[model samples]
Structure formats: structure tokens, C-alpha cells
Target: MFKKISWKWYVGAIIFTVSLALIFPLVGLKSYVNEVAIISESLMIVFSYKLMIKRLSGPVTFFLGLLVGLFWGVALFSLVGVIYNIN
Candidate 1:
């Protein structure tokens, strides 16, 4: 099912989802940010796994991608929360 889709699409979708997760809390959806972040992160992990399974990415690439996503998402959320006093 994922073979026909270009890898670029996966990357784009993951970026979009993470962006949305970060944006929502700042836009007055603080209460729902947890849900959003969880879903977004899960989606990103799944996409990374798919890329690895397809041989479009290496195991190291997949691991680093998850690490990067985790740190980026948490850091952004913390910075935004601190700056905006959202939580």
C-alpha cells in the first residue's frame, strides 16, 4: 500500500503533522495538545518505520529520525509553553 506513494509524500506529511501539533497549543488548544502530539508523534514513527521497511531508509536513519522528532517536538512544545505560558 505504501509502495506507490513517493517518499517525499511521507516526509511532507510527517512535517505537516508535527507542525500542526506544535501550532495547535499556541493557538489556544492547549488542552488538546497532548492528544495532538501523541497522534502526530505516532504517525511520524510509523512513517519512519515504513521508510525503513521499504529500504528507502536505513536502520540508523530510522532511529535518528525518531530521536530527532522526539527532541524537536518536546523542545518546541516546552519553548512554546514557556514563552506563551500556555500550561
Candidate 2:
């Protein structure tokens, strides 16, 4: 089953998930909005992890993508906090 999966699908999912993480902060400045985004990012992390588990090859690459997503999520939340502090 894992061999049947395409690399494009993995890449696309990662790209889309990370994009949302980066965009969420720019969409709103409210605390609730940020909380929602953080929740979504956490979900994305799980989603990506499941996908990685599905693949039989190159688990390291998929794990790295998961880490990147996690990092971006945390960084974006921090940025949102900074922006809120500035206002």
C-alpha cells in the first residue's frame, strides 16, 4: 500500500499544511483566532504523522517534514504573540 503512494501527494500535503500555519496569523489578531490556528496546526501535525506512517520508504524524509511543520507552527504562534504585544 505504501509503495502505491505518490511523492507528490506527500509534498503537497506538507506544503498546504505549512502554508496555513504561516497564513493563520496574518488573517486575524484576536486571541481566539490564534488559538484556533494553533489547534489546526496541531491537527496538521497529527495528519502528517499518519501519512508518514503510511509510507514504507524514506521515513526520515517524512519525519523531517513533520518536524518542519511543527517548527513553523510554533514559530508562527510566537510571531502572533509578538504582534499582539506590539498592538
Candidate 3:
């Protein structure tokens, strides 16, 4: 499923995750959380596009990974906002 995603997507994900876990704590939103979420969703699209390119050997797995990643991004932003009240 998601295996089609380029390593770049994971790189983006990791960067975003780390930013949320580390930088978001100190800087808070300042409107940055939305940017982070957008980037995360973009990464999901990248994953999906890669899957499409592969003709989707395993559509479910690929879609599920994209979905999970998208949701994870949303959830991450929500969590950061909760602790830091960036929302």
C-alpha cells in the first residue's frame, strides 16, 4: 500500500513530527500548526501519487497508510494545540 511512497514523504513526516514534538512546544502555533498539517496532508498525497504510479499492487495497504498518515498529522496538530493552546 504505502510502500509506494517515496522516502521523501517519510522524511517530511519525520520532520513534521519532530517539529511538533519539539519546536511546537516552544514556539506554539502562531499559525504554523496549520502549515504543518497542510504539509502532512501533502505528504499523504505524495504517498498516494506514488501508489498510483505503481498501479497500486496493494491499494488497501497503500490507501490505509496514506489515511493513517493524514490522520496522524491532524491528530498531531490537535495535540500540540491542546498542550500549548495554539488553537
Score every model by TM-score. Answer: 0.56, 0.41, 0.52
Per-residue CA lDDT of model 1 for 2-85, tens digit only, reads 567787887787677667766776677778776766666666666666656655557776786687568756865676577667
Q: Which runs of model 3 end up more than 4 angstroms from their true locations?
A: 1-9, 20-25, 44-58
Task: Estimate the TM-score for candidate 3.
Answer: 0.52
Residue pair clashes in candidate 1: none
Q: Largest TM-score belongs to which candidate?
A: 1
* Runs off by more than 4 Å, candidate 1: 54-87
Provide the lowest-lDDT 10-residue window in model 2.
Answer: 29-38
- lDDT for each residue of candidate 3 in 15-87, tens digit (9 for 90 to 100): 7654765475586445565666666666665655554655546666567667766786777677767867764
Error (Å) of candidate 1 at residue 49 is 1.2
lDDT of 2: 0.59
Q: What are the per-residue Cα lDDT tens digits for candidate 2 across 1-87? A: 544656566566656654554555566635455555566566555555656665645677567657856786777667656755524
For all candidates in order, the CA lDDT equals: 0.68, 0.59, 0.64
Candidate 3, clashing residue pairs? 1-61, 1-62, 2-62
Backbone clashes for every candidate come to 0, 0, 3
